[model samples]
Target: MTVKDRIVEIIAEQAVLDVSDVTMDSTLEDLGIDSLGLVESIFAIEEAFDIQVPFNANDPTESDFDISSVASIIKAVEDLVKAQS
Candidate 1:
């Protein structure tokens, strides 16, 4: 699966929703996912890509990573993956 697809998958899994429910414009709250679910999704993303996500679970707003929407998250991870190469 592509990075975006994988990201949506992880988020959907954490939120206990179907992949079809996850859209690029959808935010975590839109999926009815809580803070813990966001953290878990981040962990899953990190593990899946073998890349450390620059996210601060304690203070999400303080982090440079953007979790505002699925599309933004996918863009960030795609950038990180490219940087690793």
Candidate 2:
């Protein structure tokens, strides 16, 4: 699967929603995902892509990783993957 497809799957699983239900504009809160769920999702993404996400659990707002929207997260992960390559 493509990175976008895999990310959508991961986030959809975390939100207990179908992949079709997760859109690029959707936010974690919009999907009823709490802070813990977000953290878990990040861990899952890191493991799946084998890339370190620059997220700070203690200060998420201060972190470099953007989690504001599904599109942004996908872009960030793609960038990280490219950097690793």
C-alpha lDDT (0 to 100) for residue 78 of candidate 1: 96
In order of appearance, the predictions have TM-scores of 0.95, 0.97
**Model 1: what TM-score?**
0.95
Q: Model 1 misses residue 41 by how many Å? A: 0.5
**Per-residue lDDT of model 1, residues 1-85, tens digit only:** 8998899889889989899989889989999989888888988999999998999888888888988999999999999999998
**How many clashing residue pairs, candidate 1?**
0
lDDT of each: 0.91, 0.96
Candidate 2 ranges with C-alpha deviation above 4 Å: none
For model 2, residues 1-85, the per-residue Cα lDDT tens digits are: 9999999999999999999999999999999999999999999999999999999989987888999999999999999999999
RMSD of each: 0.8, 0.6
